[model samples]
Target: MSLELESASVEQTQEIAQQIARLVEPGDVILLNGDLGAGKTHFTQGLAAGLETPTVPTSPTFNIMFVYEGGRLPLYHFDLYRLEDADELEDIDYYGTIEGDGVSVVEWADKFEDAQPDECLAITIRILPDQTRVLSLEPYGGHFEDIVAAIA
Candidate 1:
């Protein structure tokens, strides 16, 4: 199923994501796809906050991934923007990490199809001519369907 929502400001975008974060469970995978400066990291910051992580989250564009613990569950934030190939997933143990404990939120997920999880909440953010953000959420599996419904 799918749901689309609009955000007039950065905080609104984060608020929308925070709703999802509240309902997230360990093993939940959220794949984020958006152009540069589209607020993917901003959404993640809200997610970390909802998960109760201590520090604010930053874009993992260079490091590829960052794990935030001490929250309700660990937050595994990843950025595939700098990756050239999907095979590089192994370098970061992408599968092992996402399949392990905690929730995984991957930015630039559209860049590598193979990096996507079998079941996940896929979010696409589009910037309108007025600079508003349109976030579309599509769930790929049963577990995520309920999440979508709850957030919708």
Candidate 2:
């Protein structure tokens, strides 16, 4: 099942993400899907704050991935927009990191189906006509299902 929520502003989007952050644990994978300028980074920023990460997070568009430590758990932020194909995931050790002791958040994850885990929390942010955002949260496994229930 999917839970739908609305955000009237960028701050609201981040606030909603912070709510999810509280329930996250090590080895959690969050797949983020959204269009350009759809507030994906903003949501991630809030997640980092909720996790108590020392530094703020920026989009890893050019770098592809950014690893932030010194928080409740490590944050492995990834952007797959630059990748031409799913084969490049291996070059970045994508699978290894996501399965590591950290919470993995992948932006533009829909770009490559192979990168998606069988069990994860997948979120899609849609831009509404009024410039607001509609976020749909879907859980793919039992753990994620519990999270969605708590956040819903």
Candidate 3:
């Protein structure tokens, strides 16, 4: 199953993010694919809220990943936009971190399309004219599919 939401404002987009965030649990991977200023981080803010604690920081464009603890689950936020080599993932313990602690949310995760992920939820945000936006989601694997079905 899938969901397409028309967001009228940035807050609505964050609300959408929060809704999905609430459904997330540990051992989950979320790939947020979209262009810059496309509300990916805005949605992530909502996820932070769902984590039951919130955070504000610049994008991890150079830092790679930032781990926020003290939520219902640990939230690992990764922005892979600056990565030049795929092997660098090993240095960061990429896939290994997905199931070990809290949920892993990767912005610009399309780089890992070949390596996809187990139980990964892919969210694609598209911008339109008139300040409107489209949010598309595909939840893969058993647990993530259950997340989709539950939302449906």
Candidate 3 C-alpha lDDT tens digits along 53-137:
6565357878999888887888888898888788888889887887677888899999877656856899999998776888888
lDDT of 2 by residue, 64-110 (tens): 99999999999999999999988899999999999999999999999
lDDT of each: 0.92, 0.92, 0.81
Clashes of each: 0, 0, 0
Cα deviation in Å at residue 6, candidate 2?
A: 0.1
Top candidate on lDDT is 2
In angstroms, what RMSD does candidate 3 have relative to the true structure?
1.5
Task: Give the distance in Å from residue 107's predicted Cα in candidate 1 to where it truly belongs.
Answer: 0.5
Choose 2 or 3, whichever is better by lDDT.
Answer: 2
Put down candidate 1 lDDT per residue, 58-88, tens digits, no spaces.
Answer: 9999899999999899999999999898889
lDDT of 2 at 119: 92
Ranking by lDDT: 2, 1, 3
Per-candidate TM-score against the hidden true structure: 0.97, 0.97, 0.92
What TM-score number comes out for model 1? 0.97
Question: What lDDT does model 2 reach?
Answer: 0.92
Q: Distance (Å) between predicted and true CA of 60, model 3?
A: 0.9
